[model samples]
Target: MLLLQQSSWALYEPVPESYYVHQKNINSVTFEENTTTYLSGQWQYYPKQLLQTATPTRPSRTVLLPISFKEMGYPQNTYGTFIGHFKIPKEFIGRRIAIWIPNQYGAYRMYLNGDFLLRLGKVGKTIQTQQTENAPRFAYFIAESEYFTVTMQVSSFQSLHGGLENPMRIGVSQTVNRQFQQLMMSIAGVCGAVIGVGVFTILFAIFRGVRHSQSQGFFVFGIFIIFLALHNLFSAPYVYTVFTNIDWLWGTRLEYIFTYLSAFFFINYMFLLNQRYLHPAVFTIAVFVLSFNIVITFLSVPEVFEKLVFYSFLLGIIVVLNFAYGFYQTVNRHEPYSTINLWAVVLLCVTFLHDFLLSLNWIDSVNLSFASTSFYAFLIMVQQSKNYAYHSSRIEKLNNNLLCTRQIS
Candidate 1:
């Protein structure tokens, strides 16, 4: 029998804590020969819901899904089921196990060995009937048997993508729970830092910008950072556990709204900082993108609005790339504050791409993009402070020159 393998090098094998199973996009199931067997390969997919009494037949198509359903070529706004088989490592049998879904859109239910295990949100055939889950969740169950059959029924009426975007993992309940807590702490740190930075910049812009006026960028940028921070906080699965008042639906909606607003303001901030390097066309593109987001938010239902946000995020990449090119030119010209701007742009571009991938379920990691925003704001504030001092000195020199000229006359 052929067992699934990741690569030729055993040195690169999966760690003991977790095994990254190879998943196929097809809809079918393969039972194990023995209780010790590890099942991998194509999982049967049924794009329609299975009746409570029905069992799935052979899947119609086979594909790979290391990312979200939108990228997996699945039809938008659909419901489906995925069935696969896996075995518990003998050491983990009888131990408490936690199932980890890195990312998925819509609502879903999980079953183990044909028994109902856990469900997130509400899975229904229609949008009005369906409920959505925004935060990540950990489903802990006892490994009653060595061999397990798993099924996931998912629906996505509100999101652009559905199905399992990233791979799932099963590990000891304690270990997984610990990891979850660490992730929460890391995200909380990011949120707190962003709020602190936001308040400082906004105040500086109001008091200081009133005099210099060049600090307008700080005001817009501060608001943008706050939105981005909220997005991160709301998206983290742990937030729901702490803030029970916030439901998955509104939390997710606000996450989308904040993301769209942040992108809109980000372009404005960049343009304010370096009008020489930025072009009217780039600003126009940003405006068009923001307008599209507004129309979608108002015209479409919350579910659709949330799903469509990914497209806006894609457009944001283009905006950032444009800014990167402009910053490169500034660096070449050795303009005042250009060095700081150049580095900040580079850092932002990298973090933006990282978070974008995470959003699409293309990658999974603790998001550090919020931290980058703080760094960028700090650099811009420093540059503005320097410019203020230079202006004051220039005025002082001119007044001195006027006095000497009068004395000579």
Candidate 2:
């Protein structure tokens, strides 16, 4: 019986030893008696072209297995091949053997005892796992008592962008299954909710128009919802197709512009809901600043657009503070809808904080879509409060008119 274990150098400090035991022949042997031995250590690597002719020589350079090529200090321009030699015991004649590579980049070819066994390649730009099988006899025929050699030829194209530090890992495992079904499901659910909310908001806006003609805040809020919904939908695969044909640089610029515009609209709406109209000067200044954001978004370079977006974020915080103060003043005084508007303002502020943290990568678990949903819920509550205020005002006016008419009669 042999026991085998393998692990990465970064993760584990001490390598464990494996023990093999032999017992006298018995009538029957249980499956539990069998043990696995792991072939784990540094391997000699050479350029792919040199593998065919050059004699195998151990270089002083040593790299841990299941590692990335880039981290090994290989030339940035080329992919290298790795060769490892190990001995198998003569007693392990009829047992099945398997090799596992925890991670690999781009593509890889596997060979056993200098004989080609499998080739794996990704079908698209996305990371996908593919497998090729070899006959069991190939494994049996290749097993040797002295030393069995295994070689891997791995490549990472220079043109491939993103995640350059991703590593290649190899191990031997009896089972292999790597799929992220649950994560995909969660992403899908969030995307569906975002799209659904967007659709509903658009339909509500079309049918209801502005709830109050004099309240520019109501119109702004509706427009903000529309833009936000569209942004969320665009983040998913379904609508990505329409934008895929567009130039990448322009598409990115447009995305930032839309995000800033949505934030601006929301801020303006919150101010109106709190009945705290900004002074004409402040309002005009905000408009000018937002216009500048728009103009800069069209710049060919992204750095300028990023700076404008950051400025817009700061402006949004200022607007929120202004609205909060207005709600504080009005909630205690005259406005009938003030309390509800105040609550909505508070919720909106919280949503903003959550979203900001998410954007900064400070919070990992909470999705931005949840904050958007809460925003829409708050909008509905504020709209209902407005309706209640309208009806209360109308009843009061009628009551006063009746009392005066009775006195005159």
Candidate 3:
């Protein structure tokens, strides 16, 4: 109890929590210096309305920001306007302020204090006119006064759910810039590491291969990891898409392709490892389904392909179960390092489940993408190491036999 109390006391934040907008009250909120704040909480929601002007209007309802429109009783292809207010501190008036707008479901235009600001894609009233583009962006404005109003005109015609799926960050230039840079750096570092491991794994597999050995497992694993890494690097609503000159539609397509194909390779890897346990028919079916999904993803638009993700996730669950059962059988047979392999499978499965649920919006939170990637990379390393040891032992035994024959001669 004493230790718990001490730890709780140690969790004190550096700044006060007085900056939050409560019950539509922005006057009492004071902007903190160098502190990043998410522009969440209640915002005016006007459904089926798209305004081109920054002029404020009466809202039909108030809904929380960063909420899925489907959960809020809105159907697909909903268009709306959202209004948020935050007051700048007296000292910060006339100074430069920055807002970090993360990716949302559709196209949007941001306005601050009745002035045109950031426009991401083209917001329109109909499917033909509406151009959807999802990406992380930033907007800067000089605080003309203490009271600042943010107006957003948004539309989602090609997505499953509309409205702001991600919370926007608001802060001073220095703090926001630092946070953005750190985010990008961290993403780059992680993807770079995954890519390196994949390359090394492929090379290692080639080095260990001979006329009699099955080294294609490692090769397949390495290829999948590379694709997965690419998926992570060029994830939608991220900076890499901007660098790659991809809009949300193409970026999302790449995500689905990389993700599905990586699973495809992984399934083949499993079949190679436990051919008897995983039936050939089942493996073939899985491959066919994944391939079909990839084709449909490329041909169909966002609305059409997004619905197919649920079925893909269902297939993924079946695949994970197969892996679990195979590992369990291995452990029961008392094979060497079987226990470790089983536990690794369990860890990998858990991460897969977490991300899978998040994708379905059943988790109501962000996906543990990087964590899942790390766990996968760890699993790859473990299996590769095991393969390496087995080959080394085999080589040693062959060398010993040759020496014995020479001595006898």
Candidate 4:
């Protein structure tokens, strides 16, 4: 039996005896009152077809909540029905009770007291609320006694990109936590890719005797690119193996580094496009701004630093736009290295805008995974641009030598 009591600010669920208690007090903050119940155990589950003709007289298998049926050796099929009976406690009378379902890959239909409560279809979290009156979906009756039998039936559909045997379970608290974790992981992966490619590119350039030259813009870009990747990794939960002592410091520093290096890379890229047209004054001002932001990030308090980062992101976007415009202008002028460079700049702008909008919660459907892939494509374009520029310069020199020989003859 599940008992729920609703308060003005919070909900309360009486702790069940069968609930598994993992950790009670580790860096814990005591709430005014605890308002959650662990509803996990052997739930009566079967294939969807088995439920239409007849309900099983005896349970074929008992599954756990907050877990996928596939985790229990069930086939990777969806649309199974879950039926469970719970007892309502007398203490929960006259309170608003709600169910929290974590998000799965696709859709879910839920019933309580034999009445449909809600239908949800998405890849994120969802919460369902219902009144105790009016013949609940599974079964919730006003009991004259201390306890009443409550029932719930849930049906979920398979995901579109079906590879995983286990889908994420749906419920409120778990869904919120899982989404947050996923966002961090996505950021980490992006950072790792940026760093990995940058390192290889830098080493390759140096091996080719392109040390500290204007052509080394690629290497400079690589340094900051990798720094940003490391930044993301440090900010996530999966940072146990490397740089363990100053995790928080690295995370904070990388936030500043991302903006500074991105600006620096843009400036250097412009220099590569045209050394004469590169505005030294503008580069100087950008450097000053970057340094100022880094200092602010380190000195401000944690909450204040977070706000500053958001503002800095806006500034960074403007700077990126400036670079994009420069690239466009160079390409329009038919500059020596325009073709591949312009493509790289265009791709970078698209991916940056896509990711920025997603981070701000402006677009719900944008996948960071796909966005990162686009960024990698942009990197490849930039590499091709470097190769074209090198080969073209060499050919021009050879043509000049031939002309000199003809004049001497």
Best by lDDT: 3
The candidates, ranked best first by TM-score, are: 3, 1, 2, 4
Q: In model 2, which residue pairs have backbone atoms overlapping below 3 Å?
A: 66-168, 66-169, 100-171, 101-170
The residue ranges of model 2 lying beyond 4 angstroms of the native Cα positions read 1-218, 234-247, 274-279, 338-340, 357-370, 373-409
Clashing pairs in 3: none
lDDT of 1: 0.64
TM-score of predicted structure 3: 0.84
Candidate 1 structure, TM-score to reference: 0.71
Kindly indicate the candidate among 1 and 2 with the higher TM-score.
1
Worst 10 residues of 3 by lDDT: 1-10
lDDT string, candidate 2, 1-409, tens digits:
0011121111111111221112111111111123333345556666533242114353434444544554565543355566665545545433344443322334556666455665544212222332211110111132223345556665544222111122222212232111112323444455455455545554545566656543444456556765665555333222332224443345455656666676667656655654363444555667778878878777644535655555566766766676666656665776665455456557766776776664443464344554554465556645756785898899999999999999999
lDDT (tens digit, per residue) of candidate 3 on 1-409: 1111100001112122343333344433444786878777667777777653333354567677787778778876778888776666778766667778877878888776556677888988888998998777777766656666677888888987677878888777667767877777777778788888989978877887823245787787788788878877756336465346666788888888888887788777678667744667778888999899999999989788888888767877777777767666766887654445456556766876887777667787666666677676877688767867998999999999999999999
- Residues 138-232, model 1: lDDT tens digits: 56666655555567788887775677765665466556555656666777776787778788878978987545646687788788778767766
Taking all chains together, each candidate's TM-score versus the true structure is: 0.71, 0.46, 0.84, 0.45
Give the Å shift of residue 200 in candidate 4. 3.1
For model 2, the local distance difference test gives: 0.47
- What tens-digit string does per-residue lDDT give for candidate 4 at 255-326? 445645665665665665565434566566666777777777667633455455566667566666666666
- Scored against the true structure, residue 314 in model 1 reaches a CA lDDT of 72
